[model samples]
Target: MTARTRIAAVAVALSLGVGVSACSTTTADDGPLVVVTTNILGDVVERVVGDQARVVTLMPPGADPHSFEISPKEAALILDADVVVSNGLGLEEGLERHVDAARADGVPVVAAGELVEPLEYTAGDAAGTLDPHFWTDPQRMVDVVDGLEREFAVAIDGIDADELAQTSAAYRSELLELDAEMTSAFAAVPAERRALVTNHHVFGYLADRFDFRVIGAVIPSGTTLAAPSASDLDDLTTAIEEAGVATIFADSSQPDRLVQVLADEADIDVDVVALFTESLSAPGEGAETYLEMMRSNQRLISTGLSP
Candidate 1:
């Protein structure tokens, strides 16, 4: 072979080698990725993981978890994730397939719901079904954090165990403080007025934890996607009147139209108060973090119900 031909071939090989090297460098620098389905769990995972992994949160702020869909790019990220975090027990109705695909590919999934003691809905369409909105109870959130700490240690390869432990412990401390704060704040509401009426059955855990009663919901279901029948509204109105519930809480992400309509239809006066029940709000809004969300809701519930 001629020297010129050999030189040309060598140049082509060098170019291919450089391209492959660039790809490898990008992958290494990108590090491990953790894909979280819901924004609520996203905040928790980010706090626990700190700077150890890149967290790609699919659900945006103030978005409904039950019906939020992901783009193709976001779905692709799930399949590539080293570990995926989700609020399981049928909470994320939209991203189940992507989560399933990631699990099928042998990626680790940390379902926060599965970690805590689950409660079933007592009266809604989801009655007898496991509740996924466990974050309403800070004690349950502490349980989730505990599970996440253990899972992150094993699932995230090459993570600094000491750093992970320190971060998890710090966050867990915050959760316990939150629990204490909630307990104290909720004590002010009069026992007779300790009934909760919401747009949906999203506060069962809160009701259980704080010694409040779960009156019927406008939608009469655990999911926001469920619409209320006229009879459902009638039943909830009767519940509100009988329980002497002066205020009904509605999810900020959802329209308060139904809540208002219900209030109008009620024989007794009912005030509709908005709360960050399911999703977090944008930065500078009331709820930007998990702790902030819970704290904001705690204050809202206490003030909205207390005499």
Candidate 2:
């Protein structure tokens, strides 16, 4: 081979190598690329992974997981991730397609809902359906951490298993502290006043966890995509009156129009309060992380339900 020709070939090979390395940036990091579906789960995974992996969260802050769609770039992220963590069981209606596509692409998916013991709505339009909003209960969240830690140890290359287990234990301790705080704080609310009328059936786990009664949701369904009929609102209004609920909680991410309308329609005066029920709030707001979100919601719920 001529010296000039050999030099040209070497240059071309070097250029191609740089391009390949740049293209695999996500995978070229220190550890595996983990794509999380929701901000809440993202926070949890971030805490568990620490600096071990590159955790890319798909859902933005204050966006509803049920209706938020991903961009093409975010979808590509899922396709290229080493593993995907999602709150499956139909919570993420809009992101479901991307998750399915990622799964079909042979990416490992660790679903939180499937890992924990799922609860079902007893009444309302979504009766007998599995409830996907389980993070309201810290116990279930600990289960999520356990599941995620296991997945990370197995799927994420270069992940330190002992470190992951230690981090999981530490985060689980924090979750337990959150549970204790919630239980102590909620003790102020008498059992009779523990009735909850929220934006939707998003607190079945919370109610079941702390022995609060889920009076009913304004939308009468699990997801925010569903709207309530006049009859549904009327029934909820009656339930509120009978339950003597002082405050009706609405999601901070959603419009409070329905809760206000129900409050106005009820024969008995009721206060409509907003809570960070569905999505995490932006930084500086009370609920930026999963733990903060739970604490903030606990305070709001305690105040709303207290006599």
The RMSD of every model to the true structure, in order and in angstroms, is: 17.0, 16.2
lDDT of 2 by residue, 279-302 (tens): 788889989888889998888888
Which candidate tops lDDT? 1
- In model 1, which residue pairs have backbone atoms overlapping below 3 Å? none
The lDDT of each candidate is 0.81, 0.80
**What lDDT is reached at residue 236 by model 2?**
80
Provide the global lDDT of candidate 1 against the true structure. 0.81
List, residue by residue over 1-307, the lDDT tens digit for candidate 1: 5432333333222112100000001112367888888888888988888888888777777877887787777778888889999988899887898899889999899888999999999997889999899999999999998999999999999999999899999999999999999998888888988889987889899889999999888777888777666566667777777888889998887777667766766757778899988888888998988899999988888888888
* TM-score, structure 1 vs. true: 0.90
Off by over 4 Å in 2: 1-30
